[model samples]
Target chain A: MAKKPELDDFRVPFFDDKGKPAKFSPGEFDPGAKPFSSGTKEGDRERLAVIGALLDGLQERLHAQRVRRVLLVLQGMDTSGKDGTIRAVFREVDPLGLRIVPFKAPTPVEAAHDFLWRVHAQAPAAGELTIFNRSHYEDVLVPAVLGDIDADECARRYRHIREFEALLADSGTTLIKCMLHISKDEQKKRLQARIDDPTKHWKFDVADLDARKLWDKYQNAYQDALAATSTDYAPWYVIPADSKTHRNLMIAELLLRAFEGLKLEFPPAKDSLKGLKIE
Target chain B: MAKKPELDDFRVPFFDDKGKPAKFSPGEFDPGAKPFSSGTKEGDRERLAVIGALLDGLQERLHAQRVRRVLLVLQGMDTSGKDGTIRAVFREVDPLGLRIVPFKAPTPVEAAHDFLWRVHAQAPAAGELTIFNRSHYEDVLVPAVLGDIDADECARRYRHIREFEALLADSGTTLIKCMLHISKDEQKKRLQARIDDPTKHWKFDVADLDARKLWDKYQNAYQDALAATSTDYAPWYVIPADSKTHRNLMIAELLLRAFEGLKLEFPPAKDSLKGLKIE
Candidate 1:
């Protein structure tokens, strides 16, 4: 019999203490796979609602405790459903407790500093849950794909990223990074849909096709970036995201597990307030 | 026949272009009224959900057009339901398109600068919908209640605020500010409930009780501030909030009206992309 798929099966092999991927390649994951999805969309959505409510409660506990923090980083090519996953999975969560930060092309001021400079400024505070819609990974992927950065420079950045994330983990942050993987054919279809619908043009730019033309090179850059940065402190996962429902379900499950692993509970009752009454 | 309730009946009259509330006093509006409610909690929630979905779509158009901004400011005494109102009203809105800024007690750095320094930094950018859970108004209310600022200083600060908000309005931003109003007796019950619940202790601060002890003073501060600064550019509405359901419903109605008044529509189709095909 075929084995039941576990979420860990999709996690990129964590780099060893010496900083090397045990064994991994972005190409090994099938973007079209739905290993974690239930039989139908309706069933998956029902399941998601359950997890979302639990997440909502867990997130409140996180805020109430005010000790630990959570950081969820999502990276994907255009149309790979990063925005959709956030909208669906957090549908039941309190917007007050969740913060979503989207990293766009750096400004002139941002580019003047180290790439991590801007990202570090936006790190989650105590008792906060922050999502990086796109992140510093863009720094490595874009420049490397365009040959704007040399191989040595790319290696240095990977080291910088690993060190930066390690600092976050040591400071009581739990990080979950996901790469929403989609097939080349899926990209072609999604891009065409945006092109055919003129109302979507504001989201579309002629520059997007330039990136699509470099699809293979971009994939290679992602493979290297993921392999180099996946670590025990901040592990990266490849989410087969052709099916939007499956992608939201899988990401929500991963976050739920991370929160549960913290063994969170409400802080002990305040002794001063014991039997006190507001007059 | 009894007069049908109008949303404007709750509005703290807009300050003339010359800067003065036409005829307003926060006390004139009853805190326990349910003028916007459907007469039942379940009905209020259903109405909220309907408006939430509409808000979700309108928010998307706002982002797509990238031409306008929306700012919703929520203020109230402790236990007045600022947090609850946000959770309930924005429940169905796209989390990506919404930003919530909760202003706590100013930090040392913030205190050293003018009160609006931190607030100005957090103003909504174009195509964004931002909510200020507590806002610059806190600057006026807290200090005035504490007697830290006298009448002349208070008047000067209010003028500065009116001018600052006028700048935002002229910059293509729409502002709606609501004071969630609840009765002193209702507050006593809410605070007592928190004191009685051990698990809620983290949310309870002894300082909260101190503020409650000065409830009447704070009300006076809010009254003066609202009457001084309410303007055509940024209007203040007193929301009846003794009923949590009614508070959420009324705020949702006010926001929907502000958005509809903008007459937002999706940006026109791009002629350049006509007949375009992804190769």
Candidate 2:
């Protein structure tokens, strides 16, 4: 029998690591694949809840320690389930510790600065688990596909991103970036469902169709950006997002592992607080 | 059957409203009373869920219209369930629309300004449903209980609060203030439970007990403040909060009625995009 696939199997290979250069293509992995799934839907949901409980414990420890920080960057096409994933994965986690930063289109003031400027300002501080719903990657992906930035400029921006992320990593932030991979067919179904349900129409904007028209270019832009920036310091994972449950479960499992890797423990019972009765 | 209790029955009577002047006492309301309960605990939980669903829809309309704002201010002594109330009441509401702002002890910078300065900055914007876990009421209550402020000064502060709330209401904001009323015995039990559990110690400060000892002073401060500030625009409600389920249900029902009062509706559909298929 074949050994089951591991999470690293889905990781975008490390870029330019010493003597271990690697590569990735957005198309190389199947968005519909459930390699990380717990087989049945119910089983996957149960696994997600277990992971959620574990994440909650880890998050509380993270807050208590008030030292280490975390940044989870999620980038996906419209309807790839960034909001849904957040709502589900964090169902059990205390909202106080989980900060969700959804970066919409830049305002005039934000557009005035270097792309990294606004992104830098929102980076998680100590003892935070911050999720970037769409992030600095938007500065790279949106412009590269729109022909507002050439290949050379895009390469320069990627290098800047690598350095910015490295600064965060060196300063005690553990970064995990996931690209919510979804197929064109999946996008069509999701978009149409939103259109058919007027209540959901609020979540949709007609401009989303404009993005769908440039799907191929955006896909290539994502491929280039992920391949160029996936480093051991800030690894990128291609989360198969065609299935909502699969996407949520995989992300929760990845986060659980990342948190477990932190070896977080509550601050040693405060000696000053020991057996001190409240007056 | 006894006449069904209405939400207004719990409302602190309006202060200084022409010939209809009224009075209120925090002691007059029993914290153990389940005036809004559905009799059985299970029935109360089901009622809470139904109200929660109605709030979710109303919140969606509030967001879609992007015209009106709602602010729910929750205040109580330690262990009065402000955090728990938010969690349960908003369990079904979209997180995007619900913004929970927990105001802690004022910082040096915050303390530098007039009491309402920091609070005014956090007021709900158009199309928002904002919750103040503890609010400007803290300014009046804490100082009055500590005797740092004289009665005349406390009364002045209460007047300032009424004016500030009036500003919010006049600016298209709907205000709902709930004082989660719990008994001193319940407070002792809750505080002791936190002390017994080291994990929850982070949420409890030893100083909290210092305040607990002044419980009567704080209760008197609350009575004075509520009587001075409860207006038609921003009336206060004394919530019997010993039963967590009932407190949640009562708040949910109050908000549902408030939203129902607004008669929020989806913005008319866009005609230009009607029948325009995504290419």
Candidate 3:
């Protein structure tokens, strides 16, 4: 049996000044530094390929184990590379076991239900994997920033989310939450690029800048959210997202560590499914 | 550019033998003599591995393209390996870009809304991958078999589904629907195994056998569902799933072909991210 990788082994620091946790602001983080590249000095490309191969192996083993579920929740501001990160890290994974859910603005019907109702409906089953581009965090992030709910309601939700996640973990599901951190200047440049490039025009949303205006509010929400909710069972990894390549490499490494610890093994068949006389 | 694999190359004979274009009926077709060992033959194992590699590659490329989304829906009867198939085939995929939504008994909220409401909420974003363990097809299959709704209502859903799928395709989402076909005897034995094995008891549901009693009706529903909905834009693949190894191999091959044809490429990076200019 392979020993579990240390949790610290997968940790990628997003903020340079980590001595003070609460004081770490997104703007204080240098978006231009290639933190991931710094770590990848030892053959990053080869490590990526190896991670790809290991993921392929894990997919097959997970199939035989018949545990068909993993949920990966990614939360970040614009240019955090939610799309880019997913493409770079998971490019090598099988489409069958993998499912990606991107949550947008809630429809009128969604607004009618308890916020978690829509999210629960989409949770992955055992023996499968699910990804949430933006998830129930929106209940906290959006509502907190927009004052959609009172401070007390948001606080109550923080406890509710911790319980919700604990329930999932106790029920044989592994929850990996990630917060992609990018600086405001980098976000502005990325938003500008989307406008300047015709191919990317489809991705630009005028409303994104509206969200940017409330950057401090969003950051406070994230800090409070992570501090209140990050647990031993389901922890949060804050990946620096200024460099797309670095972001991809960091996310991939974290996943590789998680899968390695799953202790997945192939389920032995009653007999090899060979030569069954099927007349 | 690599040549795209033709759809016909991955077609299974069982699909045609059960009377193509006719309503599906359980036990209507025989498990013809084994053409080859159903177990992972040497060639099959290598092919499975290759398929795994291909999926990983496609996932990354698709993520890069950031314009296309893929939805894979797996539907089948009890003990038909919907869960098993997903785990085994997609185990190697990156969890970031993939999402899995398993449609179970509808909640009061879901039941209140149109069936597609919950589904559309979980649809993949551009450059993401989503899987539905059971999908909107249940509106047709479950209702038709249980007489939950009148035949006219079920018939109406068939048309609605075709239009729904067409819309998905037109919106840059590629739809791959699969029905896992398992024999009654095989199902009984598996159910027995679940009962006999303590670790497996959690998976058994007495209600599954209740559905088993009405097997033929479910089959008829599936046939109608497939015939009416399978289209040029979104096609359905009926996989031979009695043998787990064979089922995994077939599903993997089908996906490999779908992705190979996508011609996915990485998006260009912004000049700012291309290389850092250190001060």
Error of 3 at A258 (Å): 13
Predictions ranked by DockQ, top down? Answer: 1, 2, 3
TM-score of each: 0.98, 0.94, 0.58
| Poorly placed runs, candidate 2 (over 4 Å) | A17-21, A270-279, B17-22
Superposition TM-score, candidate 1 onto the true structure: 0.98
* DockQ values per model: 0.77, 0.34, 0.09
- Scored on chain A only, each candidate's TM-score is 0.98, 0.97, 0.86
Give one digit per residue, the lDDT tens place, for model 2 in B1-279: 889888999999888845433667889999999987778999999988888788988998998888899999999999999988988888777666677788988999999999999999999999999999899999999988888899789878877998899999999999999999999988877876777777766665666678889988889888888888889999899999998999999999889889999989887666555666655
Superior candidate under lDDT, 1 versus 3: 1
Candidate 3 chain A minimal-lDDT segment of 10 residues: A270-279
In the range B1-279, model 1's lDDT, one tens digit per residue, is: 999899988888766655455766678889999997777889989999999999999999999988899999999999999999999999889999999999999999999999999999999999999999999999999999988999999988988999999999999899999999999999989988988888899998776788988988998888888888788789899999899988899999999999999889888877877888887
TM-score of 2: 0.94
Cα-based lDDT at residue A38, candidate 1: 86
Predicted candidate 2 versus true structure: per-residue lDDT over A1-279, tens digit per residue = 988988888899888945433556889989999987768999999999899889989999998888899999999999999988988898878766777788989999999999999999989988899999899999999989989999889889988999999999999999999999999999988887777766666666787788899999889889899988999989999999999999999999889999999999876554445676554
**Residue B128 Cα positional deviation in candidate 2, in Å, after optimal superposition:** 2.0
List, in the given order, the native-contact fraction of each candidate: 0.77, 0.04, 0.05
Best by DockQ: 1
Runs off by more than 4 Å, candidate 3: A1-279, B1-42, B269-279
Our model 2 lands, by Cα RMSD against the true structure, at: 2.4
